[model samples]
Target: MSIGKEILFFFGALGAFNGFVLSLYFFFLTQKKYLSNYFLGAMLLALSIRITVTVFVYFNNDLPKTYLQIGLSACLLIGPFLYFVLQSGIHSIVKIPLQWKLHIAVWLVIIMLAGFWFPYQNYPILWNNYLVALIFFQWFSYSLLSGFENRMLLQKIISDYANAVPAEKWFGTIFLGNALLFLSYFLGFSRVPFVSCITGAIAFTFILYLIILVLMHRKRTDDLFVFNIKEKKLNQEEAFVLSQKLEKLMLEKSLFKNPNLSLNDTAKELGISTHQLSQFLNNNIGKNFTTFVNEFRINEACEIMLSNEKLTLESIGYDVGFNSKSTFFAAFKKHTGTTPLNYQIQALQT
Candidate 1:
């Protein structure tokens, strides 16, 4: 093998090993509700598969033509799968429906069957791979776009948190790493295979490192045991002040129109740490960040629904920051104890 091929294989092997270990950690250590764990597992599995293919190609004197066809086809599919995993993870964090899991499972089964049954046919494998890639790519792009929207939503949430907190650095780092990884894969498929593979592996490594760091930080801070008796009293006073400020800011700014708002984003906008914002919301606001933000959104949505007789329910729900009509209705019902349409009807009757 040439020096370049040797170097590529070396990195490939390292990436595969790292991915396997990290995936195992994610699978075993993290809570199952965290969708990122599944995404990590999928990623690690894909990396392991790549490593297997690389070893086969390098050790064997004459690669089976079928292997090459299957390997390339698999690699193309893996790129989009990785993106989907990341997207799903983010959606899960925002409590959104991960409707794509079923589709992903079906596609994986089809791909595996194709690889097993007709492993050598280049056209069939390539065609299926291309079709899956197209679908995955569109979904991936939509997820990224959602992330951008979430940033704005996060800002609103932050404003409601205290107007004194700074944004967490970790989120920015993770977002950048993800973007780089996506770009690397795009470049890889655009003809520069070697560069793409090396860069993509590096990007994956960075993302894993970020996840590990977050886990470590959470562990060190004793995140789950919130009953520190000594600190509780002091924190209570601070929380009260923060909550009042945050609530006032939210009303002033009319921030309920942002659908992707998050507690972390709100904390940053307020120039406070997420922990502090979370504490304030819990102790003073008498609600979790999710509920607090949803309440505001639902209230705004009710006003819009009542005043706009010509607007459809779906349009009004979306216009006021609910990602879907169902979510809007659910949140509205939870907050006001009435369905959106019924509430509107009742308001009109009155």
Candidate 2:
């Protein structure tokens, strides 16, 4: 190989090599097993595998067909992992949902079935002419979808780059990097004379180093990648408005009476995310979701007991939303500093 080609190959191979090692570090060496980190690991692994193959094939015309198939198969995974990495970080998804699992399973099945039915060794023409297009399409489609889904974050970074948090800026860099890398490969695939096929690998090397620079500047890449998703904190004005709304909804809807009410359900009724609602309750109200809801139930129970001396303790418990007598008595005592029976008696005497 010429010296120029050798130098180009060195940088490209270095990027792929570092990426593979980083993927392993994320997968097994990280102290915390965050889902976002796991997705990031998978994304890096897929990109490294695809780029390694690209670099080799660009240099060697006689590379084995098996390597070609492996590279394309890894290419199919890159887009999905990219989408998942962004989403899992943004949405604070700690666990893999069933639908996400099913999505991955479906993609895996399709790739395996295709490879089994038309082995690249036996049907090189079919793989090259038709399957390659399909693979690239899938990769492009998911890349576009990922950007569309996370456009708000991108816009935030663009509008306020100076004040944007490290996590937001990190996310934006990743999205833009992926887009550029995809464009580089797409230009090569389109047979643009100016853009050589090896540009993709070179672009990837630059992108990877750029992302490393971002991590270095932040000095908190650990927190960012692990996705300690900073909940959107409410300002004083927003907090007051949400607090009032929460009280109004609770009083009007009597949501605590349902007995099956959950933090998620209450957050939905208040038109806020669960995390925001939880933060509001804990930080502003000085109570957790369970304690807050129980307070309401206990207050209502007291009102009922005072209004109607004819009701039994167990009956009053059920009337005010407690599903079990023991739970009702326990909460009543906790809030009032007396059992339900004692409180009722004290109230009647007063």
Please, what are the lDDT tens digits per residue for candidate 1 over residues 102-168?
6566667876776676655555555456643663475357447645644743454444544322222
- List residue ranges in candidate 2 displaced over 4 A: 226-350
lDDT of 1 at 85: 48
Residues 1-350 of candidate 2 have per-residue lDDT tens digits of 99999999999898899889878877998766878778888988988998999899889979888888988898889899889989998888889999999999998998899889988999999988998899889999999999899887787578546434456667787778778878888788889988976788888888788866765586345546643445556688988899889989989989988877877788889887555676677667877677788898998888888888888999878877789999888888888899988888788889
User: Which model scores highest in lDDT?
Assistant: 2
Clashes of each: 14, 0
After superposition, candidate 1 runs with Cα above 4 Å error: 1-7, 31-33, 47-62, 65-101, 113-175, 192-196, 209-218, 221-274, 278-350
Worst 10 residues of 1 by lDDT: 221-230
Best-matching candidate per TM-score:
2
Q: TM-score of model 2 relative to the true fold?
A: 0.65
